[model samples]
Target chain A: MTVKFNNRDPVYVQVIQHFKEQIAKGYFEPGQEIPSRRELANQLKINPNTAQRAYKEMGEQGLIFTEGNMPSCITKDEAVLKSVREELIIEAVDLFLGSIKSIDVPLSEVLEIVKKKHDAESGEAEGSK
Target chain B: MIEVKNVEKKYGKKRVLKGLSFTAEKGEITCLIGINGVGKTTIMKAIMALTPINSGEILIDGEKIRKESFEKITFIPDTITMLPQMKICEAFAFMADFYKNWDSKRADELLQFFKLDSTERIANLSKGNMAKVNMILGLALNVDYLLMDEPFSGIDIFSREQIAEVFTSHLIEDRGVIITTHEISDIEHLIDRAVLIDNGEVLKEFSVEEVREKEGKSVVDVMREVYRG
Candidate 1:
């Protein structure tokens, strides 16, 4: 997963965002084994305890599962994965709604903006990195 | 009662704590808030006698936090790991044997609240489960003060809600609690007083009501500037 800290929100929210990024990037499939807390902790250099916390949170949200001592795994059910992805997309939309909320943009207008921006950004996307 | 006046700490050449002073009274839940790596934990450790400060005097209820006052205060930091090899059913008993303040009744109640199978080995418990154990021990103790650093950082949001409630009713108002955490939103409504720290210094102290009226900002937002980059 891609974990990054954002001071604007709580750390656990950042963890959830990281999980969403992993899902988007195809590194974590619906039914694949997630990294163990210790491994992730070593990778991120945070306390193993904090990484364990992220895993525990993910499990509680039904995004992943672990049977007691079993290694924690992402829910591999395709339907479940699609649904979680949809939830993430909705969360992102709501986060960015401020841009459109005040303008009272209809669905068609929003789609037009999106379509226009996509083509324009695609031409310059690689340069952003 | 705790006091630190004009205290300073330096890690080699880098100054962590500048001149700082703050007094935490009995029966008060004083929250300490700051950004990361600001030495909030170091101050707590100093209060707990876990770490010695280079220059500072930490007094508890008029007496300095020396060998004698250590037992009067209880500290539960984040990630208090019990020996993974042991079971809670056994370890609870072991803790009872050591800490005379331990109350078996409260511990049992907490075990039920957490729905923990006491027979399950500590290694088998989830992070949330382990945090529950730590929470139980802190509540079971009969002490004048409890200090916790980042207690909510390791638990799920749902569990954090439960723990916050537990903190409200179980926490003794006649005693005291000093909590250091980055999750200010989690405890903003719970804590009565706020202690804002930065670079190991006390920047401001405001009552929950005082902060709202005087600063026109939540304690979290007010303190964010103190630890601002």
Candidate 2:
């Protein structure tokens, strides 16, 4: 739940992004209960008002839901969950491509290096496990 | 809301606050940020009526501050106000005697929250512990508004962090907090609004998130523009 928030972005926006990343990474399961606004504020060391704003925004975006007098939970909608993961992948790709483009690397060359590095990293993970 | 409308104050030959004005609303943490001797504390004292204002007015909930206002608002100075020889419990007792709105239960809760032993004398506590005790005394009061002067100043990182957590926790729930600080890095995310002052006048008064959202500027960025621009 630790997020080193950048000061330029709105805190509530960062909070939403953190939740999106957690959901995409499967760290937060679909329909899993989330901390209340006050609890989240205390945990994140942010203002409670900011936390409430985040929750309200998340609710409007359908990233989370709340029942009557119940705590908020991650969206149980499978399509939305899948889109969250896809959105993160696209964002990472966009960032990588943006930086790689500046280096003038060919698409084929970049793909080869990425595949090699990713495979090696996964192999190392498997070996360690 | 606590409103300071064109408040002016002078110290004998020196005028510290010149037409300083700002409003701190209930359930928001408003920070008064400026360099030293910019009348941040003076503005707070004027709000509390600890120092008489030469002109203009200070109001709590639309009414000028009076004797009854003391019960509705509490001031936590940078240093502990209790006697050095007094034990923490004794200080609590003194507060209970002086302030009718003092809540002993909340005091005990805050004591545990800070992990302080009430039997220890104020003279024996560390600087951080003394600050914690000072915060406890003010927070334990059933007040709607709190004015704190540099609650994070001159403290270790961990102690400052603990005090910052108090701003988020239920201890500060629903109360308007006005804290003066030259340092804004520690609790930038915890404060709702920032009132930047320079030479006893408000240079900028804006919501932290609003500025971040609209202009992509952090509080420090705004401060840089206001103070150094």
lDDT by residue for model 2 (B1-229), tens? 9999998898997989989889999999999999999999888888888889999988899998888989999999999999999999999999999999999999999999899999999999999999999999999999999999999999999999999999999888799999999999999999999999999899999999999999999999999998899
Q: Which candidate's DockQ is highest?
A: 2
DockQ of 2: 0.90
Overall lDDT per candidate, in order of appearance: 0.74, 0.94
Which 10 consecutive positions of candidate 2 chain B have the poorest summed lDDT?
B42-51
User: lDDT of model 1 at residue A114?
Assistant: 89
Q: Taking the candidates in order, what DockQ does each have?
A: 0.02, 0.90
lDDT of 1 by residue, A54-113 (tens): 787788878898878888888766776787778778888997787788888798889898
- Deviation in angstroms for B157 in model 2? 0.6
Could you tell me how far off, in angstroms, the CA of residue B36 lies in candidate 2 after the best superposition?
Answer: 0.6
Fnat per candidate: 0.00, 0.87
Which parts of model 1 are misplaced by more than 4 Å? A1-129, B224-229
Worst 10 residues of 1 chain A by lDDT: A1-10
lDDT leader: 2
